[model samples]
Target chain A: MQQLPREESLRLLGSVPLGRLVFTQNALPAIRPVNHVLDGENIVVRLNDGATLTSIAPPAGEAGLVVAYEADAIDPHTRLGWSVIVTGYARLVADPSQVARYEELLRPWVAQTMNGVLRIQPDLVTGFRLVAQPAVAVCAAGGEGR
Target chain B: MQQLPREESLRLLGSVPLGRLVFTQNALPAIRPVNHVLDGENIVVRLNDGATLTSIAPPAGEAGLVVAYEADAIDPHTRLGWSVIVTGYARLVADPSQVARYEELLRPWVAQTMNGVLRIQPDLVTGFRLVAQPAVAVCAAGGEGR
Candidate 1:
């Protein structure tokens, strides 16, 4: 496994359309699989009515709700893929025009009445990629022969 | 989307070898993609030396550390699959015999010395499956004609 740079990590994150959103529910961690889009450096997702995440309120005098978003594209058989994690604060896009813009860009996978939009401003972005090992022994043997 | 029974949820979880482990770090949410195995009703995962999870101690008088485990098998194109979330308390397997058994059962995907074993006793299990909607209108028309 190799650590990825922030720019590369965010790029990879934007490449995938689906990710898992993690947040605190009743002080315990809760995860939901949701489709997302990257708006510049921030991650955006749509929430349906009555969704618990829509009801999460930010702490008093805080920016937004602290949450983590994780996305990966690992091959189930070979396990060779990249995983990106973004820890950030998620805030609802309350502006009518901004919500309409997001609605035009992203479509919910499930057939639900999605009206709430969330924008996550990342605080920390980390990622890793699993790559096949290089043939170091062969290179060393060839160098010796030369 | 349809809800899955606890038994079916666990069975789907065991079928997949990879899952994301959600935990608290510095009082903020953190996520890690790790491979896991189901030991009956409990989920077991291996942690390497110096891993943060290995150092997580249960609160005083508490059964274990609270954590969440999520696994899913969704088709990227169709987005039709099942996702299972298990919220529970994680405890290190300190017994030598149990550790040895887990060591034999699971192999770490990364090339790291994984010596610590964690068993998550689930407190809540929930799952949902995304299925294509049936052609109800066509069936209803055929019934009316008959």
Candidate 2:
């Protein structure tokens, strides 16, 4: 495995539309799979009124809620791909025009009504890529060096 | 989207070997991608010494650490698949014989020394499946007579 640079990591993160959102629920960790759109360095997602996340997300002017977002694309058979994790503060979008723009940009995966928009300003971005073993190293380990 | 039964959820979870582990770090949520094996109702994963998870996992004979495990198989194109989330307590496997058994059963995906093993006893198992709209519903919405 190899570490990915911040720029490369963000690029990979933007390539995927779906990711898991992690937060503290009842003083314990909770995860929910959600669809997101990368807006520059910030990640934006839509939530419904029924979602607990919507209630927990900090409102416009208040301090943002700390959360983690993770996404990856690994082949089930090959197990070779990249994974990215972004830790940041999430806040509810209060601007009506901005919310309209995000609505035009991101389409929720589910059919439920999504009235809440969240913007996460990432503080740390980390990623890793899984690669196959080098053939030369494998050959050396097998004592079949060329 | 449809809610999945507990049995079905576990079945889908076991079908995938890779999942994201969610835990708390410095009072903020953190996530990591790891390979796991489902042993009955419990989930087992291997971690290297450098992994903070190993340090946080409760030792044997102590109360388990609260964490969440999530696994899914969703197609990027169609965006249709099942996702499973298991929130529970995690504990380090202290039994040498059990550790050896897990080591033989689950081969670590990364080429790293995985000296620690964690077992999570799920307290809550929830899952959802994203299914295509039924033909009848689509026809009704489109006002096209079939």
Clashing pairs in 2: none
Per-residue lDDT of model 1, residues A90-136, tens digit only: 98887788898997677666756786888899889999997754332
Worst 10 residues of 2 chain A by lDDT: A136-145
TM-score of chain B of 2: 0.88
**Tens-digit per-residue lDDT, B1-146, candidate 1:** 88999999999999998999998888888888888899999999887643676678452245788999999998766668999999989988878888999876676666567867888988899998987654323222333212
Q: Which runs of model 1 end up more than 4 angstroms from their true locations?
A: A49-51, A58-62, A134-146, B59-62, B134-146
* lDDT, residue A136, candidate 2: 24
Using all chains and alpha carbons, the TM-scores for the candidates as numbered come to: 0.87, 0.90
Q: Among the candidates, what TM-score does chain A have in each?
A: 0.85, 0.88
Tell me the tens digit of each residue's lDDT in model 2 across B1-146: 89999999998999888998889987889888888899999999887653576678878789889999999987666667889999999999989999999986667667677888999898899999987665424432444324
Best by DockQ: 2
State candidate 2's DockQ.
0.50
Could you give the DockQ of candidate 1? Answer: 0.33
**In model 2, which regions exceed 4 Å deviation?**
A49-51, A134-146, B49-51, B134-146
